[model samples]
Target: MLTTLLYSPQDNSLIQGDDSHIAQWQQSDDAILWLNIDGELTEPLQAMLKQTFNLHQLALQDASRDRHPPKIEDFGDHTFILLRGLSADSESINCDNILLAMFISERFIITRHSARSLSIERTMAALHAGDISLATGTGALSLKISRFVVKRYHKILFDLETRLEQLESVMLTTADDKVLAEVVLYKTDLTRLRRNFHYHVELFNNLRDEPSLPFDSALAHEINDVCEHQHRAASLADLFYQVASDLIDGYISISAHRLNNIMKVLTIITAIFVPLTFIAGIYGMNFEYIPELKNPYGYFIVWGVMLCITAVLIWLFRRRKWI
Candidate 1:
């Protein structure tokens, strides 16, 4: 769907409209037009962007395709920026990041996204509530949106930090396969979040240096701030991954230690019984010349011998602290 918000600087008021009024507002010389498209761009919407906004066909294709990395393309008259906003819910580790495509110039701004974006929603709400004044130029508005996207990354980073903490806490007291699996998952998701921001860090730096658009010092500073935050988020992700990797190694080490202890106990028991088994095998020999078999207390004698050997082995093991 298409949502339009027109900001007239004279009255400092926003005029909201639908697709029907897009053409009328697209040509307005006095107002700054904001066109937002949610979901895949249909033919008509594509045609509108092409004819009205003069958006490049290549940029449109990139916006519609999957797995387009965050980037900025300088189209001379207008700049096309592609950004990915991370989702905060760690539970949905497999969910894809939200893709946002923006076209900005002095006169208008167009934002397109494939999926629902909380940051975009918040930006739009702020604009509609008149919380953001039109005086902050289109570049600052773009920066505001980028900042919101970075804020989402911060939320995911916080979640990652919390998850690693929980894993570390439980790792010592309760190490298990489930906990290890969770650590691995956290690392994977953290890595994904880092990768998303890594691209933005570069993209924003290049955007700030774009020669075609004269970015004000304030706007440039905000872009730099966004880049710094992205770098921070990426660094946090790496740290979390390392912690999680350590947790996995620790869990494995503990498991191996327990298994070794169990095996050691079993070996000690077998060692204690080996000598007794040897004596019993001798007594069971069917030789007619066996003198012990002829004795009346031979069975008792064998039992006494076996008990003595078992006691001696147990005592020896205890002395050596092996049991």
Candidate 2:
């Protein structure tokens, strides 16, 4: 869908317009126009962008690409910005990042995104409600939208931290394979989150050097705020990933130590039975000339010997603290 909100700085009035008179509206310099294009960039839409906004071909091409990280391109007449907005999936571990493309010029701002965004909706609602307190200049509007996107990141980071804490709690109660799998899954998510926010840091830094936007000082300050936010989010992600990894390792080490103790106990039991088994085997051997076969008390003597051997083994094991 294509949505447009035009704000006249002179009268402080806001009005929504259709695509039919967009080109005519662009001819006016008295108002700041915000054109938001959502969904795929069809050929006709691309043509409209070219004819109405005079956007460069390369910039349009970059915007149309299916996948691109956050970046900025200075096209002399205007500047194009590509940003990532995170959308968390509560039902599952996997999350998504929506790509937002924007063009900022002297009198107009164009925003394009493949998916619905909270920032866009909020800004539109504010504009429709005639909230002119926000500066309608292209630079300020872009900064506002960027700030909203960063706010979303803050929520995602908080969720990540909460998940890690919960996982750690569960891990302490049970050190099992299922818990380990969850730890690894959360680690993967943290890694991806860090990568996504890292790219935003670079994009915001580039925005700071942007020469096309108006009000350099204000724009730079806003960009710096975004940079700081991205840095904080990325750092949190890194810390969470490391914590998850350490938890997994600790659980595995505990499991290994438990198994080793079990094996040691079994080994001690087998050692105590070896000599007893040998004595039984000798008495059971079929030999006609065996001297014990002619003796009446041979059975009692062998029984006493076997008992002694068992008692000696037990005493030795106890003394050595191997039981």
Candidate 3:
């Protein structure tokens, strides 16, 4: 789907419409043409974008596939940027890669996205809320949007750290695979976030040097701080994996010890019964040669012998500390 929003600086009016009717918004000095695209865009729409905005063919191709890494590029005529957005839910974490093509000139600003992202939308909201104003130009809006990306990276790290602590507590009492699964997921989420955040950090750092798109001096300081945050988050993720590996080793050692104890008990019981069963089997053999069949006290004598053997076996096992 393609929808347009025209922000008119004249009356602080917002206009919503399709392609043809949005041009009337050009009358305002602070007018912006915002195009939001969701899901799979059709061929005609792609062609329209290419013809209307003169988007590079290669950049359009990159937008079609979702795994593109986050970065920004200035093509002299327009700027092409790819960013990662949080695609999390109550169940599992997912990452959404969005392509934002910004066409900035003296008269207007046009932002095109291949998919919807909360990060982008929130920046738009901030722009509405006066965090960014039209007098500051499109450069201010771009910096605010990148700042949102940096903020979300911190959130991902915070959440991962919390889950790891919970997993560590679970490991102390019970050996479980669920905690491991959670660790695996958290690791993956952090890795994705770190890589994406790093790319943008580099992008912004490079932008800081370019005088044409001079970012606010205050935000320039934030670029370095955001880079440091990404580094810390990535380091913590590696530490979690190391801790998880050690826990797994401890669980295996415990399992082996329990098995050994069980085996020792079984061995002692089997040894005690073997001789007794042999004696009973011999006395019960075919009657032709059996003298116990004639003796009246024979049954009691055999019972006494079996009891003595059982007591001796138990005593031996206890003395050897095999129980």
**CA RMSD of each candidate after superposition:** 2.8, 2.8, 5.1
lDDT to native, each model: 0.79, 0.78, 0.63
TM-score per prediction, in order, is 0.87, 0.87, 0.66
Over 4 Å off in model 3, which ranges? Answer: 1-54, 74-78, 88-91, 94-115, 134-140, 150-164, 167-219, 239-257, 290-322
- Candidate that beats the other on lDDT, 2 or 3, i.e. the better one: 2
Q: What would the per-residue lDDT of candidate 2 be over residues 108-200, giving only the tens digit for each residue?
A: 888988877778887787666756333547887787788788778777667767877887787777767888988888888778777777888
Candidate 2, 271: how far from true, in Å? Answer: 2.3
Model 3 TM-score is 0.66
Model 2 TM-score is 0.87
**lDDT tens string, model 1, 163-258?**
678878888788577888888887787677768878888888787676345255767677788778878877877777788788888888888888
For model 2, the run of ten residues with the poorest summed lDDT: 86-95
**Of 2 and 3, which scores higher on TM-score?**
2
Over 4 Å off in model 1, which ranges? 20-27, 86-94, 209-214, 295-308, 311-323
The number of the candidate with the highest lDDT is 1
